[model samples]
Target: MDAPTVSRDFDVVVIGGGHAGAEAALAAARVGARTACVVIDPAAIGRMSCNPAIGGIAKGQLVREVDALGGAMGQVTDVAGIQFRMLNTRKGPAVRSPRAQCDRVVYNREMARRVVEAPGVEVVAGEAIELLVEPGASGGSRVRGVRLGDGSEVLAPAVVLTTGTFLGGRLFAGEWEEAGGRMGEAGAARLSRSLLALGLELGRHKTGTPPRLCRHSIDFDRLEVQLGDDPPQPFSFRTGRLDIEQLPCWITRTNAETHRIIARHADRSPMYRGRITGVGPRYCPSVEDKVMRFADRDAHLIFLEPEGRDLDDIYPNGISTSLPPEVQEEFVRTVPGLEGARILRHGYAVEYDFLKTHQIRADLQVAGVDGLYAAGQINGTSGYEEAAAQGLMAGANAARAAQGHGPFVLDRASSYIGVMIDDLCRVNPDEPYRMFTSRAEFRLLLRSDNADRRLTPIAEELGLVSAEDGERTGRKERRIRAAVERLRSVRQGERTLEELLRRPEVEIDDPAIAAALEELGLAADEASEVEAEVKYAGYVARQAAQVDRMRRLEARSIPAGFDAASIRGLSNEARDRIARRKPLTVGEASRLPGVTPADVQVLLAALSGGR
Candidate 1:
């Protein structure tokens, strides 16, 4: 033995230091596989590239999934969040979500610390030039390792490419075009070419951030103070019920004057003037797009948020721009809340190379190659919450694959994480995908409150969650069942949890639990539980039936090496997609839009005939 081959090799090697890579490398390590994170800078690990915060609207569910599986994002958000708000309280459980504004410095520090402290992870700073592939059986490519620019070869059984905004990343604002990723960092120039060389379909996407304004220069008296919840809620279930010191945020609006200024400078705007080359997110548009699209609206809400407790930087949430400096200053001055606010950094849009999500499976594994995966913005998704969720799933599955275990997939009814992944695999968004409440077909069953209820068991199977998490799931499940039983057992005319939740006037307690402790307080807890379960009980049951039906089809697995071309009735697109994708089950096959029900029947017929 020549001293055990001097080069360090691991079971999984995660590329990129953003949200996805941090979660992916950490998950694989936590699941007991040796993991290495190849990054550009150690200080920037888990950096919030677009914004310095976590959890909002539909995104909160993704954070919850990370928490349920023992990932670090939830913990970091809980610790560093400055302002915490639960949105859509008037809506049902599925639509209700928790949003937080974090001190950016604290958030990144917390995440980086967790990644370094993880059991089986090593973080190295460098750039991967290309991948090394060896020919496996039947013409499939087996990944050997990644070669870095510094001339070091990192070997592993598997590779997860989370090259967010680094694959030939280019930025354009008006006449200016630069070679960089986010924050003027050196990007992966050759890695995108290397991936395309491996025959993956790549696309381009652009996203922008608002210029950071000096906190001291802003007129605080003009803005409305929006404080965090009285009793703040933490994103991580692992965090004990209480914490010290909650942070507050301010809210303001961009008036007609502000919109007019942005419109006047629209010629200089990169988005409309055709200076930027890639598609931007639809939901989050630049000030120019918002003004152009909603001309009738007089004002748009803008949130004044702190980047971190230590830094003087503040993120102006609603006014993402790629305008010139003079135009930005004029527009900032026109806004009701931001008058005389001095800009610290210029807001600009970055265009980066991305993959058409169909190139990878829901588990983030790439086609035509064993032990190769992708996640985060690389997979054509936006937002840190979205990236972290994808990374967690990919990391756990990669770990399971290394252990010779099954792939970890959480279905749509189970978690918003499932809906996000499924949408990536099935819906194939035309633009950069961001999570919205409308994305899920079975959202009624997937709520932020119950992420552990739906996904902790599966996470346990993947060994991403500790054995103790099983108890968290059990306690919640028991409480849910107890409430349901009491609902069914109670007599008519007398108030029940279901009855109380439906009544506008009758709350958890008709007397309201806080004041009327003398009477049976069980009704309040009962109402809370029933409100969660019964909000869309009918819709949830329907989705459950669909899931059950799909699982039955999934259970009837075709043997490995089964060919899709041999099956009849598959449409040309379906046949081509299935052949390239090699989906694991009939259910997965059915999820692909081009693959029809008839194709599934044909596959069933082919498998039965061979049997």
Candidate 2:
């Protein structure tokens, strides 16, 4: 028998082509690594497996950060966005976010195009079933390559597992169960076995999507229209403006009748029927869960979102479920404006394997496994933004490790992405983790508008951002500084424009302020940033002070291979947790579960070599 054909060696192998896989492969290749992205289907590389929306609340900040780090999500969303809105526009700048409803086909196509066109990136059509590993000099096995289902092997020093909801995936619809990932994709059943065999513990997580309905079948006249933002802002800094035609979404409320239908069939839902044992995102509950949990509420809002400009399918946004097809149709028809709606597809739940993130270090590398990394849903995160951010970090770190460079670490104070990773690794979330603006303690400084300011220079230093991108970012920064100076110098009444703008009643659009911004040639977005920074300066400074004090603990690095078990005063739980997590900094150790402040004090003394 002939041996299976073997591919040439690669510097990095990215498994699965979901959001995380796409960003990981692109980032690694962009960093000059010889990277190969192995996917079950090349055409479905960036398929929007769930909702076709990008960025919301804290998630928007993440996408911005990813873009600033030279990731592709922001750009793709710009091209595919149909309806753009700045969420929380009336709120403080810290919570203000940009969200876009994307044309799923366009978004996926654009991402796939970029991935396939990326330099040094190879799109390999295959299902990776196993990781090739060999005993390492450091005691643990080192990742060598990946083994595909076709029996072909592609050797690489680094491998990023971003398999998403495909590993050991099992879909549930009412009492029905099937082995699949997304709608039509196959589950990577063999890969789950491989991970388990490697002694990696895997947890189960489930997420569901709302049913897609035929657009023509819905009664739109009865629903309230939600218009896109006028002069919409694009997610990418590279995008000057979004000139694409905007589409309107319709808002309709689920009536008591709708709730009754769902309640009657609640027990039939896979999510409620004991069929799905995996934990789902508590923040994004299903219709059944919503009805059961929020029983006092008479109705719920559902946004009828267009799937695409050319497509006739509509997504009912707020009623995701895993109920039967008939039940779905019945409840959907009971909605205020969906009385005649026809189901394009029934919503279903997918339970898949995810690695307990605590086993994954802050840099996204799997603990005790050299050259192996994990990202996205596989890392127990619930959103595309979270996955992409993790992918960027994991891929960059993997490349750095392959090239003998140091791992890139981000702290909670610097970026929302940093806060997310820190939270994931230390919290060891029991439910699927989702990002929220409330999660960031220093969100005032990590606003979506200034993501580039916080991350671009660092990305440039790491070779992830291009010189041209760096120059553009520098120019923007200069414009912002000049604007700030002018605002401070120009006086209206006894107060300078900056001081006046700080007043709650004084608006940035006031005659004097607008005139100054116009004369400076400062764009509205730029002016908004300047105003926010100045107005919130005192609050931001206080937050920065807190961050600085915390940085002392963060700067104190725990010795590599430190014996946490030997710590004399720690509780048994703290000792075990610290030993298992191997936290690199005193800050990280303090955040770990079971490690109390007193334990941290003890740790501080012991690590200082004074205990």
Number of the top TM-score candidate: 2
Residue pairs clashing, model 1: 104-307
Compose the digit string of candidate 2's lDDT tens values, residues 1-611.
Answer: 24658766889999988899999999998788999999999999889988899999999999999999999999999999999999999899999999999999999999999999999999999999888899974577899998898889988889999999999999988889999988888899999999888889999999999899999998888879999999899999888888989999999888788898899999999877788899999999998999999999998889889989899989888899999988998888878778888888889999999999878888888887889999999999999999999999988988888888877889999999899999988867899999999999999999999999889999999999999889988988999999889889999889999999999988888899888878778777788889888899999999999999888998888877799888899999999998888888899899987889999999999988977
lDDT (Cα, 0-100) at 536 in candidate 1? 55
Worst 10 residues of 2 by lDDT: 1-10
Off by over 4 Å in 1: 1-6, 492-505, 511-527
Per-residue error at 487 for model 1, in Å? Answer: 3.5
Per-residue alpha-carbon lDDT of candidate 1 for residues 251-366, written as tens digits (9 for 90 to 100): 88888888888888888887777767688899999887898899999998888888887789989998888888888888899887678799998888888889898777767788
Task: List residue ranges in candidate 2 displaced over 4 A.
Answer: 1-3, 566-573, 598-611
lDDT of 2: 0.91
Report the C-alpha displacement of residue 484, candidate 1, in angstroms: 2.6
Global fold similarity of model 2 (TM-score): 0.97
